[model samples]
Target: MILIVVGVIMIVTSLVSTVTTNYKKLQLQPTTESPGRDDWHHFSTGSYKLFPTEVNYEAAKNGCRNANARLVTEGIRNKVTRKSIMDEMILPAFNANKLGEGYGVWIGLDDLEVINKWKWIDGIASTNDNTAWAPSEPNNGSERCGMLHKLLKWLINDEYCLVANAYVCEIAKSK
Candidate 1:
Protein backbone atom coordinates (compact mmCIF):
# COMPACT_ATOMS: atom_id res chain seq x y z
CA MET A 1 0.00 0.00 0.00
CA ILE A 2 2.88 2.41 0.79
CA LEU A 3 4.47 1.75 -2.58
CA ILE A 4 1.17 2.44 -4.36
CA VAL A 5 0.78 5.74 -2.50
CA VAL A 6 4.31 6.78 -3.46
CA GLY A 7 3.55 6.05 -7.12
CA VAL A 8 0.33 8.03 -6.99
CA ILE A 9 2.16 11.00 -5.41
CA MET A 10 4.77 10.86 -8.12
CA ILE A 11 2.08 10.96 -10.80
CA VAL A 12 0.40 13.92 -9.14
CA THR A 13 3.71 15.80 -8.94
CA SER A 14 4.43 15.13 -12.60
CA LEU A 15 1.00 16.40 -13.64
CA VAL A 16 1.42 19.56 -11.59
CA SER A 17 4.83 20.25 -13.07
CA THR A 18 3.56 19.84 -16.60
CA VAL A 19 0.67 22.21 -16.02
CA THR A 20 2.93 24.85 -14.51
CA THR A 21 5.44 24.61 -17.35
CA ASN A 22 2.76 24.99 -20.02
CA TYR A 23 1.25 27.98 -18.23
CA LYS A 24 4.61 29.68 -18.07
CA LYS A 25 5.24 29.01 -21.74
CA LEU A 26 1.92 30.57 -22.76
CA GLN A 27 2.68 33.65 -20.65
CA LEU A 28 6.06 34.08 -22.32
CA GLN A 29 4.92 33.69 -25.93
CA PRO A 30 4.44 36.92 -27.86
CA THR A 31 2.08 37.54 -30.78
CA THR A 32 3.76 36.68 -34.06
CA GLU A 33 2.15 39.61 -35.93
CA SER A 34 2.93 43.27 -35.41
CA PRO A 35 0.44 45.85 -34.13
CA GLY A 36 -0.35 48.69 -36.53
CA ARG A 37 0.49 50.02 -39.97
CA ASP A 38 1.31 53.44 -41.38
CA ASP A 39 2.80 52.29 -44.71
CA TRP A 40 5.50 51.58 -42.14
CA HIS A 41 5.00 49.31 -39.14
CA HIS A 42 3.88 51.05 -35.96
CA PHE A 43 3.18 49.95 -32.43
CA SER A 44 0.09 51.70 -31.05
CA THR A 45 1.66 51.96 -27.62
CA GLY A 46 4.64 53.70 -29.20
CA SER A 47 4.96 55.92 -32.26
CA TYR A 48 7.94 54.93 -34.43
CA LYS A 49 8.73 53.60 -37.90
CA LEU A 50 10.88 50.55 -38.72
CA PHE A 51 13.17 50.57 -41.75
CA PRO A 52 14.53 47.05 -42.25
CA THR A 53 16.97 47.89 -45.03
CA GLU A 54 20.69 47.24 -44.56
CA VAL A 55 22.99 50.24 -44.16
CA ASN A 56 25.97 51.33 -42.13
CA TYR A 57 25.45 53.58 -39.11
CA GLU A 58 26.24 56.81 -40.94
CA ALA A 59 24.14 55.95 -43.96
CA ALA A 60 21.33 54.78 -41.67
CA LYS A 61 21.36 58.11 -39.88
CA ASN A 62 21.19 59.91 -43.18
CA GLY A 63 18.38 57.69 -44.41
CA CYS A 64 16.31 58.33 -41.36
CA ARG A 65 16.94 62.04 -41.65
CA ASN A 66 15.76 61.99 -45.26
CA ALA A 67 12.58 60.20 -44.21
CA ASN A 68 11.84 62.70 -41.43
CA ALA A 69 12.66 60.13 -38.76
CA ARG A 70 15.66 59.05 -36.72
CA LEU A 71 17.24 55.73 -36.01
CA VAL A 72 15.18 53.88 -33.37
CA THR A 73 16.08 54.78 -29.80
CA GLU A 74 13.81 57.17 -27.93
CA GLY A 75 10.68 55.07 -28.41
CA ILE A 76 12.44 51.93 -27.19
CA ARG A 77 12.96 53.22 -23.68
CA ASN A 78 10.46 50.71 -22.21
CA LYS A 79 9.95 46.97 -22.50
CA VAL A 80 6.68 47.07 -24.43
CA THR A 81 8.07 49.24 -27.22
CA ARG A 82 11.30 47.29 -27.34
CA LYS A 83 9.51 43.96 -27.64
CA SER A 84 7.28 45.30 -30.39
CA ILE A 85 10.30 46.44 -32.38
CA MET A 86 11.98 43.07 -31.84
CA ASP A 87 9.01 40.94 -32.86
CA GLU A 88 7.69 43.11 -35.66
CA MET A 89 10.80 44.59 -37.26
CA ILE A 90 14.08 43.16 -36.02
CA LEU A 91 13.10 39.48 -36.12
CA PRO A 92 11.71 39.64 -39.66
CA ALA A 93 14.74 41.55 -40.91
CA PHE A 94 17.08 39.03 -39.32
CA ASN A 95 15.18 36.09 -40.78
CA ALA A 96 15.25 37.58 -44.27
CA ASN A 97 19.04 37.97 -44.06
CA LYS A 98 19.58 34.26 -43.40
CA LEU A 99 21.43 33.84 -46.71
CA GLY A 100 24.87 35.16 -45.70
CA GLU A 101 23.53 38.71 -45.70
CA GLY A 102 24.58 40.44 -42.47
CA TYR A 103 25.25 39.97 -38.80
CA GLY A 104 22.84 42.45 -37.17
CA VAL A 105 21.10 45.84 -37.46
CA TRP A 106 21.82 49.31 -36.11
CA ILE A 107 19.57 50.70 -33.35
CA GLY A 108 21.18 54.09 -32.66
CA LEU A 109 23.07 53.06 -29.53
CA ASP A 110 26.82 53.58 -29.65
CA ASP A 111 29.77 54.41 -27.42
CA LEU A 112 32.08 55.62 -30.15
CA GLU A 113 32.36 59.11 -28.73
CA VAL A 114 33.38 57.83 -25.32
CA ILE A 115 34.32 54.45 -23.87
CA ASN A 116 31.50 52.67 -22.01
CA LYS A 117 29.27 55.69 -22.35
CA TRP A 118 26.72 54.58 -24.92
CA LYS A 119 24.40 57.17 -26.37
CA TRP A 120 21.77 57.18 -29.07
CA ILE A 121 22.33 59.13 -32.27
CA ASP A 122 19.64 61.58 -31.12
CA GLY A 123 21.78 62.38 -28.06
CA ILE A 124 19.81 60.34 -25.54
CA ALA A 125 22.10 58.84 -22.93
CA SER A 126 21.83 55.07 -22.52
CA THR A 127 21.84 53.52 -19.08
CA ASN A 128 22.59 49.90 -18.19
CA ASP A 129 19.09 49.51 -16.71
CA ASN A 130 17.28 51.02 -19.72
CA THR A 131 18.62 48.58 -22.33
CA ALA A 132 19.49 44.91 -22.75
CA TRP A 133 22.98 43.82 -23.80
CA ALA A 134 24.18 40.36 -24.75
CA PRO A 135 26.57 38.56 -22.40
CA SER A 136 30.13 39.94 -22.38
CA GLU A 137 29.14 42.36 -25.17
CA PRO A 138 30.56 45.80 -26.02
CA ASN A 139 33.81 43.91 -25.52
CA ASN A 140 35.50 44.97 -28.75
CA GLY A 141 37.12 48.32 -28.13
CA SER A 142 37.48 49.20 -31.80
CA GLU A 143 33.92 48.23 -32.82
CA ARG A 144 32.20 51.13 -31.11
CA CYS A 145 28.89 50.98 -33.01
CA GLY A 146 25.77 49.39 -31.50
CA MET A 147 23.40 46.86 -33.05
CA LEU A 148 20.48 44.62 -32.19
CA HIS A 149 21.88 41.09 -32.05
CA LYS A 150 19.62 38.77 -34.04
CA LEU A 151 20.47 35.56 -32.16
CA LEU A 152 20.33 37.14 -28.73
CA LYS A 153 16.64 38.13 -28.63
CA TRP A 154 17.46 41.54 -30.14
CA LEU A 155 19.86 42.38 -27.33
CA ILE A 156 22.22 45.30 -27.99
CA ASN A 157 25.89 44.79 -28.90
CA ASP A 158 28.77 46.87 -30.14
CA GLU A 159 30.24 46.15 -33.54
CA TYR A 160 32.44 47.82 -36.11
CA CYS A 161 30.94 51.09 -37.35
CA LEU A 162 32.13 50.56 -40.91
CA VAL A 163 30.43 47.21 -41.38
CA ALA A 164 27.09 47.62 -43.12
CA ASN A 165 23.99 46.05 -41.55
CA ALA A 166 20.23 46.49 -41.60
CA TYR A 167 18.87 49.41 -39.59
CA VAL A 168 15.62 50.49 -37.92
CA CYS A 169 14.24 54.03 -38.26
CA GLU A 170 12.08 55.85 -35.71
CA ILE A 171 9.47 58.44 -36.69
CA ALA A 172 8.01 60.38 -33.83
CA LYS A 173 4.26 60.87 -33.68
CA SER A 174 3.28 64.22 -35.09
CA LYS A 175 1.52 66.37 -32.51
Candidate 2:
Protein backbone atom coordinates (compact mmCIF):
# COMPACT_ATOMS: atom_id res chain seq x y z
CA MET A 1 0.00 0.00 0.00
CA ILE A 2 2.90 2.38 0.85
CA LEU A 3 4.67 1.48 -2.43
CA ILE A 4 1.52 2.26 -4.39
CA VAL A 5 1.20 5.67 -2.69
CA VAL A 6 4.87 6.49 -3.36
CA GLY A 7 4.51 5.55 -7.07
CA VAL A 8 1.38 7.68 -7.37
CA ILE A 9 3.12 10.63 -5.69
CA MET A 10 6.09 10.25 -8.06
CA ILE A 11 3.79 10.26 -11.11
CA VAL A 12 1.95 13.35 -9.86
CA THR A 13 5.21 15.16 -9.12
CA SER A 14 6.54 14.33 -12.63
CA LEU A 15 3.40 15.72 -14.24
CA VAL A 16 3.57 18.90 -12.12
CA SER A 17 7.21 19.50 -13.04
CA THR A 18 6.53 18.98 -16.74
CA VAL A 19 3.55 21.32 -16.67
CA THR A 20 5.52 24.00 -14.82
CA THR A 21 8.35 23.79 -17.33
CA ASN A 22 5.98 24.08 -20.25
CA TYR A 23 4.27 27.08 -18.62
CA LYS A 24 7.58 28.83 -18.17
CA LYS A 25 8.54 28.22 -21.78
CA LEU A 26 5.27 29.64 -22.98
CA GLN A 27 5.67 32.68 -20.77
CA LEU A 28 9.09 33.34 -22.26
CA GLN A 29 7.63 33.47 -25.75
CA PRO A 30 6.94 36.96 -27.11
CA THR A 31 3.38 38.12 -26.57
CA THR A 32 3.39 41.54 -28.21
CA GLU A 33 4.49 42.60 -31.70
CA SER A 34 5.20 46.14 -32.82
CA PRO A 35 4.96 47.60 -36.35
CA GLY A 36 7.36 50.43 -35.32
CA ARG A 37 5.33 53.43 -36.47
CA ASP A 38 2.65 55.26 -34.52
CA ASP A 39 1.52 57.53 -37.34
CA TRP A 40 -0.03 54.59 -39.19
CA HIS A 41 -3.78 54.54 -38.77
CA HIS A 42 -6.49 52.03 -39.59
CA PHE A 43 -10.26 51.89 -39.99
CA SER A 44 -12.45 49.25 -38.32
CA THR A 45 -13.01 47.39 -41.59
CA GLY A 46 -10.15 44.87 -41.65
CA SER A 47 -7.64 47.30 -40.09
CA TYR A 48 -5.72 48.89 -42.98
CA LYS A 49 -4.29 52.42 -43.02
CA LEU A 50 -4.09 54.80 -45.98
CA PHE A 51 -1.28 57.09 -47.06
CA PRO A 52 -2.92 60.38 -48.02
CA THR A 53 -0.12 61.90 -50.04
CA GLU A 54 -1.00 62.65 -53.64
CA VAL A 55 0.93 61.29 -56.60
CA ASN A 56 0.35 59.85 -60.03
CA TYR A 57 -0.73 56.23 -60.22
CA GLU A 58 2.67 54.75 -61.08
CA ALA A 59 4.54 56.94 -58.66
CA ALA A 60 2.01 56.31 -55.95
CA LYS A 61 2.31 52.60 -56.45
CA ASN A 62 6.09 52.89 -56.31
CA GLY A 63 5.85 54.95 -53.17
CA CYS A 64 3.68 52.36 -51.51
CA ARG A 65 6.12 49.66 -52.59
CA ASN A 66 8.97 51.61 -51.03
CA ALA A 67 7.05 51.75 -47.78
CA ASN A 68 6.47 47.98 -47.82
CA ALA A 69 2.81 48.52 -48.61
CA ARG A 70 0.59 48.73 -51.65
CA LEU A 71 -1.76 51.37 -52.97
CA VAL A 72 -5.25 51.20 -51.37
CA THR A 73 -7.08 48.14 -52.68
CA GLU A 74 -9.21 46.26 -50.21
CA GLY A 75 -12.41 48.13 -49.41
CA ILE A 76 -14.15 49.51 -52.48
CA ARG A 77 -16.54 47.01 -53.96
CA ASN A 78 -20.31 47.47 -53.62
CA LYS A 79 -21.86 50.88 -53.05
CA VAL A 80 -21.94 50.32 -49.28
CA THR A 81 -18.28 49.32 -49.07
CA ARG A 82 -17.34 52.07 -51.51
CA LYS A 83 -19.10 54.64 -49.36
CA SER A 84 -17.44 53.24 -46.28
CA ILE A 85 -13.98 53.49 -47.84
CA MET A 86 -14.65 56.96 -49.18
CA ASP A 87 -16.04 58.22 -45.89
CA GLU A 88 -13.37 56.56 -43.78
CA MET A 89 -10.31 56.90 -45.99
CA ILE A 90 -10.72 59.22 -48.97
CA LEU A 91 -13.17 61.81 -47.67
CA PRO A 92 -11.02 62.71 -44.70
CA ALA A 93 -8.10 63.41 -46.98
CA PHE A 94 -10.26 65.45 -49.29
CA ASN A 95 -11.64 67.39 -46.36
CA ALA A 96 -8.11 67.99 -45.14
CA ASN A 97 -7.04 69.31 -48.57
CA LYS A 98 -10.21 71.35 -48.99
CA LEU A 99 -10.55 69.76 -52.38
CA GLY A 100 -13.64 70.27 -54.52
CA GLU A 101 -16.17 67.71 -55.72
CA GLY A 102 -14.47 67.18 -59.10
CA TYR A 103 -11.25 65.93 -57.54
CA GLY A 104 -10.21 62.25 -57.61
CA VAL A 105 -7.87 59.90 -55.82
CA TRP A 106 -5.94 57.07 -57.40
CA ILE A 107 -6.87 53.67 -56.07
CA GLY A 108 -5.10 50.29 -56.49
CA LEU A 109 -7.42 49.24 -59.26
CA ASP A 110 -6.82 49.33 -63.00
CA ASP A 111 -7.86 47.74 -66.26
CA LEU A 112 -4.57 48.57 -67.88
CA GLU A 113 -3.59 44.96 -68.33
CA VAL A 114 -6.75 44.07 -70.21
CA ILE A 115 -9.34 46.58 -71.28
CA ASN A 116 -12.50 46.56 -69.17
CA LYS A 117 -11.08 43.77 -67.00
CA TRP A 118 -10.27 45.61 -63.79
CA LYS A 119 -8.09 44.07 -61.13
CA TRP A 120 -6.87 45.25 -57.78
CA ILE A 121 -3.12 45.34 -57.29
CA ASP A 122 -3.53 43.26 -54.15
CA GLY A 123 -4.75 40.30 -56.24
CA ILE A 124 -8.27 40.38 -54.84
CA ALA A 125 -10.51 38.80 -57.44
CA SER A 126 -12.61 41.05 -59.63
CA THR A 127 -16.22 40.06 -60.02
CA ASN A 128 -19.51 41.76 -60.82
CA ASP A 129 -20.49 41.45 -57.15
CA ASN A 130 -17.18 43.02 -56.10
CA THR A 131 -17.31 45.98 -58.45
CA ALA A 132 -18.33 49.53 -57.57
CA TRP A 133 -18.08 51.11 -60.97
CA ALA A 134 -20.05 54.26 -61.57
CA PRO A 135 -22.77 54.10 -64.20
CA SER A 136 -21.11 54.03 -67.62
CA GLU A 137 -17.70 53.65 -65.98
CA PRO A 138 -14.77 51.49 -67.11
CA ASN A 139 -15.95 53.42 -70.08
CA ASN A 140 -13.47 51.89 -72.51
CA GLY A 141 -11.20 54.86 -72.57
CA SER A 142 -7.47 55.20 -73.19
CA GLU A 143 -7.01 56.04 -69.50
CA ARG A 144 -7.13 52.38 -68.46
CA CYS A 145 -6.86 53.20 -64.75
CA GLY A 146 -9.27 53.42 -61.83
CA MET A 147 -9.87 56.21 -59.39
CA LEU A 148 -12.42 57.21 -56.81
CA HIS A 149 -14.16 60.05 -58.64
CA LYS A 150 -15.44 62.43 -56.03
CA LEU A 151 -17.83 64.01 -58.53
CA LEU A 152 -19.47 60.67 -58.95
CA LYS A 153 -20.06 60.34 -55.23
CA TRP A 154 -16.77 58.52 -54.69
CA LEU A 155 -17.48 55.77 -57.11
CA ILE A 156 -14.88 53.90 -59.13
CA ASN A 157 -14.17 55.24 -62.62
CA ASP A 158 -11.48 54.92 -65.23
CA GLU A 159 -9.00 57.74 -65.46
CA TYR A 160 -5.70 58.45 -67.13
CA CYS A 161 -3.00 56.53 -65.28
CA LEU A 162 -0.52 59.36 -65.78
CA VAL A 163 -2.78 62.04 -64.37
CA ALA A 164 -1.38 63.66 -61.25
CA ASN A 165 -3.83 63.10 -58.44
CA ALA A 166 -3.97 62.49 -54.71
CA TYR A 167 -3.72 58.79 -53.95
CA VAL A 168 -4.48 56.46 -51.07
CA CYS A 169 -1.99 53.77 -50.05
CA GLU A 170 -3.00 50.75 -48.05
CA ILE A 171 -0.76 49.07 -45.49
CA ALA A 172 -2.11 45.96 -43.91
CA LYS A 173 -1.73 45.81 -40.14
CA SER A 174 0.38 42.95 -38.95
CA LYS A 175 -1.28 40.44 -36.70
Using lDDT as the measure, the top candidate is: 1
Candidate 1 lDDT over residue span 66-151, tens digit each:
87678777656667778887777666655676313667778778887888788877787887787678888878888888887767
Highest TM-score: give the candidate number: 1
Q: 101 in model 1: Cα distance from truth in Å?
A: 1.2
lDDT of 2 by residue, 1-175 (tens): 9999999999999999999999999999986554543555555433444555556789978986776667777655435445666776667868787443335877788877777777888777667677677798877678787888878877778888877777765565421
- Per-candidate Cα lDDT values, in order, are 0.75, 0.71
Off by over 4 Å in 1: 1-37, 44-46, 96-100
Q: Output the lDDT of residue 16, model 1.
A: 100
TM-score of each: 0.69, 0.67
